[model samples]
Target: MTNNGNKYLAGAVSFAVFAGVVGPAAAVSWTPPGVTMGVPLGAAFAPGIYVSNLTHYGDGPDKSITADVPAFTWSTGWKVFGASYSAVVIPEVLKVQNKVTSKDFAGIFSPLLIPVSLSWNLGQGFFVSVGEGIYFPFDSDVSFTTSGQTSGWAAETRVAFSYLKDGWIVSANTIYGVTTADDIGRRQPNYFNVDWTVARTFGKWQVGAVGYGAWDLEETVTNAAVGKGHIVGVGGMVGYDFGGSKLLLELTRAVEQGGATNYSRNDTHVWARLTFPIWKPAEPGEEHTALK
Candidate 1:
């Protein structure tokens, strides 16, 4: 019989072992400046920080987990051949606690995630983006289970589209992910994620509703007619644009789930992101200087 034990362990380990553990909301929460996925901001650099708090409450009272993550991100982009290309790197610190056991695990300098993407403006308020991301296990020694340590790489590809007109914004982003096998020869099932947002702008502030869902594509080892991993969430988001800087806040609650999913019922997630331009292109006839 296929051992299903590793599947549960993989879920928990993936959360605690990776830097992107902000929660399911993190998978689809970010919207690039201008809320246009296909329009490329030219020759700019942005360095920002994000802080997230996530709480997970399983069906059993002893299954509660809480985590706080502080992440630092750097992004740079340039225009290329009528398309925009950008890359981002994120590194994070993790602090997770088990409410029932009162046990805490603090991880410093977790894995790093690098994503590279290219976008094209399809004109008439339509845009498209295609990108891939990779996660490098920088802290491979940390283990969430006694069965084995977590050490592996992950990779994913994403496609996104958006429409913007008259201060109204609508977009959808999707991702597919797979990971390498762990020391115990257990591999995480391939998964698909979908995220969407709809918002209207009022001067400098934009308000919207956001939703996300994830589903595992493969069946579990036992083939016990159990549904694959699945979870869904919905929330509200607000943002303000300040010239070259922007601030965004979002809160979401898990509304649906399958037994094999990683999230808990009624799980809550809160996220805050601030981004500011570090470098900007020169204006017409402007002198190029390091200070500028």
Candidate 2:
């Protein structure tokens, strides 16, 4: 809401799915990136319920993956330790197809839960926040997760910061994740991703450059030769507010890649997000800060 009388939400949720293949035909991935970008973390959403649908489609390395992720968020008027609090949950679906044949290969469910998120507005347009997320695999074929099977749980800790003032926004978020071993004792490597966004919102239109870097810190437990996967990409983002709803579109192409088995080093990602409020307090002003 760039032009909503200089207003912005305190915190919300966003998500996507990634499946890459770089050098070899190895394993599959279910890493969802870009959850807390394009907004100030220290701001507050009006105390109410909001929902979003995030879609990610990537076609590369002989395969294509499409993920439609649905999320529900609850913004509270309550505050703890001088920060606004929120919670979110996402239940996602992953569909994979062959690029050449255009036929379905695999599909499964991967879900995420963020029971805690807090944002702190530090005056002068500076905001910071912290959150924790848990990911679960409902099926063994969940995006063909991990080296072999995906029967264990995973945890992620993330932090976000932003500076929003005068229609200008500079924001960044970090994610560090660790996964437990599968049923067969095969563990996916620990991973880290950083999302950086810089945009200017004017007259209900927002445009900016967005980029991210993702790296797997350890090799697959059973594949000693598979080392790790790492890639970086930069792209453009455009957003517009239509009445009470907002839509954001982003496209990024990998500019660097190396040492990956199931990760496509050279890949492109097209992500879209649609967000709107499901319900809100009648006197939003009493529970909402409106803007940071």
Worst lDDT 10-window in candidate 2 = 6-15
Clashing pairs in 1: none
lDDT of 1 by residue, 189-223 (tens): 56777777787778888789877777777654333
- Quote the RMSD, in angstroms, for model 1: 7.5
TM-scores for every candidate against the unseen true structure: 0.71, 0.82
lDDT of 2 by residue, 146-188 (tens): 3244456778887877877788878888888877755455445
Question: For model 2, what is the alpha-carbon lDDT of residue 177?
Answer: 84
**Cα RMSD to native, each candidate?**
7.5, 9.7
The lDDT values for all models are 0.47, 0.63
- The count of backbone overlaps in candidate 1 is 0
lDDT of 1: 0.47
Candidate 1 accuracy as TM-score: 0.71
